[model samples]
Target: MLRNVATVIWDGVAPFEFGVVCEAFGLDRSDDGVPLLEFGICAPQPGLVRTSLGFGIEVVDGLGRLEEADLVCVPAMRRGDPLPDGVTEALWRAHDRGARLLTVCSGAFALGEAGLLDGRECTTHWKYTDQLSARFPEAKVVPEVLYVDSGQIITSAGTAAGLDACLHIWRQEYGAAVASAVARRMVVPPQRDGGQAQFISRPVPEIDAETLGPLLAWISAHLHEELDVDSLARQVLMSPRTFARRFRAETGATPYAWITAQRVRRAEEMLERTERPVEWIAGEVGFGNAAALRHHFTRVRGLSPQAYRRRFACGESAESA
Candidate 1:
């Protein structure tokens, strides 16, 4: 149903993230049976735009091209640049015409500035969560998720999370089959729930190289087991306090939080790939029971596992037939 898409670009754009949007939507993957997305890249001025990394990108279209698009995408911006004056007006016009608006990373700042996110649930990169909340108190900013889709407006976290949001749009517009095929061609996961926490720095003590790698691997493999800091510390021949310190330094997260995230990731994979009962899957993923899994899954993914499974896996049976 997405017949045409326009990506808005500006000076000091993050090239790789900008390219991710183009790669996902601009290319024709019809040979692989994927629906073609009519894509156009536009800038405020129809000329060369300087990237944050000191490179020039030649964009041929200007903001006028966005007038007829079914969707408008805004890529991440450099840290502190002011948005163009007319750009927000152009976006407001597009929204008034009923076009969907999307943003990747700091691109949400533009949406916030345009007054589109007021009284809506939205998200941006965790690094800017506080700033976004402070700047737009009327907008509900969810910092932990990979992305947020509030009907007509969609926003995502940093870099790779942009890919997830794009694929989500594909799934919503077409279906999971098409989104999965596109994801396969790109060699990325088709869906990652947006609510996963951004990995942040912790304050663990340093461990010697000889024992660290094996210990970490062992913990990952035994996630289904009862893993307390004390037991893990014993395996690495360190006190609980010392192990906690080292984990923070090495992984940029506490051991407990990291373990929970890994378990949730596994649960998501099962929800997409298998038709097991939620209660059983919860126990298998080390949540101990279904209620605990539902709590954490909702907290981390912004949806119950059942709701996510229904969205992505519902049509599988029909397709298989």
Candidate 2:
């Protein structure tokens, strides 16, 4: 459904952030049965654009191109620089016309300038989250996740997180199979939420091994087993209270939260890779029964297990749904 994507660039744009946007949408992957996206770069002045990294990229497209885009992405810009004439107004028009909007890192400031973020749940780079909050007092700025998708308007954290945000849109619009294929092409995880409960079932892209790492691996290996705060605390050689505190401190989540996420993640994999019945998958993932699994899966993913499998399952047999 999101066929046309236009990325807006301007003076002082961060190159890496811009490239993340380009890599996410600008590449051709239809060879893998993914839709070929119509991606382009647009600039307000329609010529050479200066980057924060001391280089210039020649952009041939202008804001006029943005008018027809299904989605408009803005990359990180000079934190406090002036927006070019008509840039902010164009963003407003895009939003007014129902175009999807996405921002990476300090690109959020551009949305803030257009008054799009006010009263909407959004996020930016952790370093700039406070500043974004201070600048746009009405916007709900969530500082701790890989990205935030408040429906049509999506915002991501710093750097590679932009990839996650883009893939999220892709998964929603097309399906998980398409998103996964694109991710494999990019060599990045299709989804990662950094242990926040809201982004349930999505794994963190990667983690460096430590005391918490071994615990996480153990939990993943035994998701169907009863895993409670007290039981896990004993494994870690600490009191339940201390274990909860330490888990949150190290992983940004509580013991119960992590285990629940792990179970949901297992459900997702089974739903995608196997044709097992919902009741069977639910019990295997430790949700105990279909009713309980539906409650948590719907609460977290906004879709039921059957619907998720129908939409995301991998092969021709998956079409049976």
Candidate 3:
């Protein structure tokens, strides 16, 4: 249960993300008779902090305030800049004293820089996924999900996703009912399971009106079929090389990658809607075997097929038995 929370601020901090954290924890919510959170903004200098959006905020506390906090939050920062030396040291001290560390959006960069996320599952805004993964390979970077809660450390995706993460923390500490009440007071959805996808770039395929649309429709309807690029090319009356080039140009992904993504999408739908055996679901998704299905599903979804099914399958038996 978190009663005391502190947010660390620096120059160039995003105003909107910072405000989200403040609204979640800093506001006096005792009017509704809910347990009020002790929240305040802390800076290294204890003065006006300039925001990314050309405004200055007067903060009263400094990094020393974090020592008494049960939870510490760092909001988004400008991409590709070194965090201030004092802020880094303060974060390290707070973590050493057993504060639950949290980062929203590019704040993960700060955590990653401090090496707090090493070997932990985490995520940030999808736009920074590649750079974050490259910078912190030791940290398992899960790009698609809204947030990752790895016990003492948590990281969330872009802007609005931070709201979901904060609500989740409230739920875990005070139970869903209290969290729901807080959400109603705040006028937002009470619970958005952290496993929900973040903003993903979707590039639709382009084919000549004569051939492409129908071919994609066929592939989607018959995912159980073996969809080799050579065979698909033959269906569209083009050579494999030409077909592969066209597919990549249109969809911004290779044929194999696109097919694997679609198969995983189908598997996700089935796992949510049915209680099929993992092996059977793998076969139906054209993965040939459960192992291959698990491989690709984990690659895209960050969870094994069995785990995904368990999370979503609603307790029904396979084939409605």
Candidate 4:
């Protein structure tokens, strides 16, 4: 039922985030049995808008285009950028008319400025989650997830997560088959688990846990082995209790959790790049069997191993391209 997508842009807009919105709704995929939408780019000023990377693009449409769109998307904006009052009024008017609103990255800040994020469950990029929470006390900021779809308003994390959020919308409106088709063209996973936490840099490297970094790297390399806190602790020459404490303090997750997360990440790479069978991938990534791999993969990615392979595997598409 969703159609007529509009992307709003402003000065200091991030180009890649804007492109994510465009890729989701702007494509002419009618030949592939996908719906074609009336996608347009709009800005309040209706002229040149500068990108965060010091580039400029001409905006041919003005705010009037948003009046006709069934969905409005806002891309990431530069931190501390001034959001014009007209943009907020346009957003409110679109939402009042039952248009779905979505924001990517720091663009949530613009929604926060518009008062739309008030008392709503939302998220921005992980690095900026604290700032967003501090700026809007009424809004619930979920930092760990890739995106949040609170029905009418969808907010995503950083750059690549915007693609995830957009694929989620495609899956919701057009079904998995259609979403998979679009994602195949885009060369990204058709759907990713929104609840899956982003793999942060040393996700939690404080608390003098820097020594655990090398151990994590080792586990990432040898995911095929059966691993446990006790064994891992032995490698670091610490007691199991002390190692568990240090692991949680450093990575914000247990040994099992961190290992499963990394295994899932490895499986994803193989799923996308190789034509290998699920059973083989399971063993290769330490899941031991297809069923276990499927369980953990689904828990982390919101889709089955076979389903992910079908949707993302570079099979016929990669060779033909």
Model 1 stretches astray by more than 4 angstroms: 1-5, 23-38, 52-55, 64-71, 78-82, 93-109, 116-207, 210-213, 318-321
C-alpha RMSD in Å of predicted model 2 compared with the true structure: 4.1
* Model 4 agreement with the true structure over 1-321: per-residue lDDT tens digits: 788999999899999999989888898988987889889999999899999999998999999899999889999998687786489899999999999999999999999999999989999888999999998999999997889988799999988899989988886665556777888888996656576565544555566645687898899899999999889999999999989877866665678887887788788767767777788888999999988998998866677877776665555642211
Each prediction's total of clashing residue pairs, residues at least 3 apart in sequence or on different chains, is 7, 0, 0, 0
State in Å the error of residue 201, model 1. 5.5
Candidate 4 minimal-lDDT segment of 10 residues: 312-321
lDDT per residue for candidate 3 within 175-276, as digits (tens), equals: 445566678888986765566667423345335334365777788788888999999999999999988777765544567877776787678767766777
Give the RMSD in angstroms, all C-alphas superposed, for model 3: 8.4
> Cα-based RMSD of the predictions, in order?
5.1, 4.1, 8.4, 7.4
State the lDDT of candidate 1 residue by residue for 1-321, as single tens digits: 688999999998888879878988999899987878789999999899998898999999989989979999999886466778689899999999999988999999888888899999999988899999999899999876788989899999888889989988886766556777899999997766555445534333335344366877777677678888999899888899988877766655678887897787677667766788888888888898889999998886667888878765644752110
Q: What is the TM-score of each candidate against the true structure?
A: 0.68, 0.86, 0.63, 0.66
Q: Identify the candidate with maximal TM-score.
A: 2
* Strongest candidate by lDDT: 4
In order, the Cα lDDT scores of the candidates are 0.82, 0.83, 0.80, 0.84
Arranged by lDDT, best first = 4, 2, 1, 3
Q: Is candidate 1 or candidate 2 better by lDDT?
A: 2
- For candidate 2, list the clashing residue pairs, or say none: none
